[model samples]
Target: MAKKVWVERNKDGSWDAFGDDGAHIKFGHGQGLFDPGDLMKLALAGCAALSSQVAVESTLGEGKGATISVDGTYDDELKGFASFKEQIELDASSAGLHNEDVEKFKERVQKHIERSCMVMHTYEHATPVSEEITVKQ
Candidate 1:
């Protein structure tokens, strides 16, 4: 299935993005709003956490969760993010994962995210974007 989303500028000059599920996010150049770069980082972190959820829960117990953070520096010259770093903090001791087991679990989680996280995959491999312009007379 194809999903469609759009961003519209409000009369107050702020922008709101709408998704197919009726969720809206306030975005613009101001406080309490997310810019495009901020949304990108959020998406990356969310994707990583979701894609690795199965592996994490299976080994770390169902209730155990993790914190995933993504950071990147915006480059004015390039007008885009230079690079992104993703960090995941997980406590394995609760699940009794020792040195070897912990190492294996780390590998498993990495594999799961790398294999299934579409956002990370897009970052790794460049996806082409094309734009079409329309003029109202």
Candidate 2:
């Protein structure tokens, strides 16, 4: 399924993004909202965290607790992201899983998340983006 959003510039030089579900997100340098770079980092982190959570739950059953921390390095010279990292911490004792099982689960989850996360795959594979602009008089 394809999703779409509409964005328009506000009078104050900020921008508003509108989704089909009526959600609104404001963006600008001074709009007190998330800027483009911030949003990009957020998207990446959120995707990784969510994917890791799913992996952990599937491996250890539901109610298992885990924490995922995601970080990305922005390259100012290249004007893009340089690298990304994710740390997944699982509560194996609470889940009552053995050390060997936890290790295996962690390894499997890591591999699956690296391949399954859309945002992470895009970042790693360097997806191409193109834009065209038109002026109406």
Find the candidate with the highest TM-score and give its number.
1
The TM-score of predicted model 1 comes to 0.89
1-137 per-residue lDDT for model 1 (tens digits): 76689999999888989989898889987888888888899999999999999999999889776799889988999889989999998878768767899889999999999999999889888789999999999
Misplaced by over 4 Å in model 1 are none
C-alpha lDDT of all candidate models, in order: 0.89, 0.77
TM-score of each: 0.89, 0.76
lDDT of 2 at 94: 56
Residue 101: error of model 2 in Å? 1.7
Candidate 2 lDDT by residue in tens digits, 8-116: 9989898999988888888878757888877777777777666677677786678664676667788999988788666767766656777798788888777767877
lDDT agreement of model 1 with the native: 0.89
Off by more than 4 A, model 2: 11-14, 30-32, 59-66
The clash numbers for all candidates, in the given order, read 0, 0
Residue 92 CA displacement from its true place in model 1, Å: 2.8
For model 1, what is the error of residue 102's alpha carbon versus the real structure, in angstroms, after optimal superposition?
Answer: 1.0
